[model samples]
Target: MPRIVSAFLCAAFIALGVTACAEPAHQKHAPQDPPDYKGVPTDMTPPSMLTPSAKPQ
Candidate 1:
């Protein structure tokens, strides 16, 4: 009876281990797009674009 019980417990542990190791492989993460700067320019033109003739003194 003891041997039967030990065998059952061992089988249960083995089944659990097998299931734990059978998880699906991790998926590759997709690269996220950079934030939009659609209406904005990167560089600022000197003397202001608003006042074209205002030269630096």
Candidate 2:
């Protein structure tokens, strides 16, 4: 009985710790309008998804 109770307590503590560490939900910024493309290149990959080109300095 004591072992079961301790195990339950430990499991609960871990769950609480995970919940506390999570990022809080909040209202995100409204989407921005697309920028003018006249001067910009047609290809626009997100910075995070971009890979380094083979060309070196």
Task: Please provide, for model 1 over 30-56, each residue's C-alpha lDDT reduced to its tens digit, 9 standing for 90 to 100.
Answer: 666568745666568765566666579
The lDDT per prediction is: 0.81, 0.85
Give per-candidate clash totals: 0, 0
Residue 36, candidate 1: how far off, in angstroms?
Answer: 17
Task: Name the regions of candidate 1 deviating beyond 4 angstroms.
Answer: 25-57
Q: For residue 29, give model 2's deviation from the true position in Å.
A: 6.8
Root mean square deviation (Cα) for candidate 1: 11.9
Each prediction's TM-score versus the true structure: 0.41, 0.44
Evaluated against the true structure, the overall lDDT of model 1 is: 0.81
- Model 2, residue 51: displacement in angstroms? 24
